[model samples]
Target: MESSPQVYVKAPPPPETLGRPFELMDHHGQEVTNASYSGKWLLIFFGFAGCREACPTGLVSMGAALDALGGEAGQVQPLFVDVSMEEPDITGLAQFVSNFHPSLVGLIGTRAQTFATVRDFKIRREYAMANYSTKETGPRINHTAYLYLVDPDGVTRAYFDHTLEPERMALTVRLHMKRRRTSP
Candidate 1:
């Protein structure tokens, strides 16, 4: 008798990060940490309040994506962490983040703390200052732009680049949630 062909299966991808600890202050002067968000999904983004285009776009898209999730929105929390040397004060940063999404939590810290968190998350960032003698525009910042999707356990489940649309983002998040529910 002829034997049936062997079947192959692919395993699920592992988390990008096992989870990194960080301590930051919210816009409200409240302390926040990786442990603070335990038992809840986290949609984290690193950007600055001074950013004009990319930051606004990412934040708006994040709000739209969360809205698209409907009732499931409550299951995930959005966080905006400012890593700029020109980081705004707590009040300003809070206002900036809230302007994008009322539910979005804004975080800020000392230069050292911000750098440490950036290193922990493996995010790339640099200050772009224009020469004072030149006619170029004022200084700005360059940094990695990605939306990190972290599971309730704090492990990074996946990441979405700047090119992903809001609708697709919502779908992607839903798929992750489904996978987690079915996994052993």
Candidate 2:
């Protein structure tokens, strides 16, 4: 009997419908919509101010990824959307964002707007009373920690897990940019 060689075929991925339109206020108190950042790519992460672990880790990684991008970093706008139900003032949001990248913008919206954005992003979030809860210390928010990459044309190009390395993240973004540039 004679043996035949086998071939493998891969199918294209389904189109993503991950992100949606949002209207929020920046840390600077400026109103912004999804279309506000029309000419630049958006790197967005959703987390709360009270998140002590995952949020900082994700933000740091995101900052490092932007740094790794070097000149290409200017074309990307990094955003940290506050998903907490509690209202944090502009000063606090400004301080929090300053701790991350210089260009990282913190977004906060009304409860309804935040809820809509969270739902649109399909983020799973919950609030749990902390073990060391005090009058000042509120319930901690637990939410999904995925990073979203949105292209200039307001399309979600890709998303990355929290654990991905900064260098790898930058490389992935670079690849996506290259593909977009070369495509029709």
Give the candidate number with the greatest TM-score: 2
Model 1 lDDT on a 0 to 1 scale: 0.82
Pairs that clash in candidate 2: none
lDDT (10s digit) by residue, model 1, range 1-184: 9999999998633557523778889889998897898877899889887777678889998999999999888889999999885554887787688788778999898888888888877788877664321421335677888888998877788887755799999999999998999999
Error of 2 at 112 (Å): 1.1
Cα error, candidate 1, residue 62 (Å): 0.5
Which portions of model 2 miss their true places by more than 4 Å?
1-15, 129-137
How many pairs of residues in model 1 come into backbone collision?
A: 0
Q: Which ten residues in a row have the lowest lDDT in candidate 2?
A: 129-138
With candidate 2 superimposed using the best TM-score fit, by how many Å does residue 79's alpha carbon deviate from the native?
Answer: 0.1
Q: What is the lDDT of residue 48 in candidate 1?
A: 82
* 78-183 per-residue lDDT for model 2 (tens digits): 9999998677577877888899999999999999999998887778898766643342234677798989998888788888877789999999999989999999
lDDT of each: 0.82, 0.86
TM-score of candidate 1 against the unseen true structure: 0.84
Among these predictions, the greatest lDDT belongs to 2
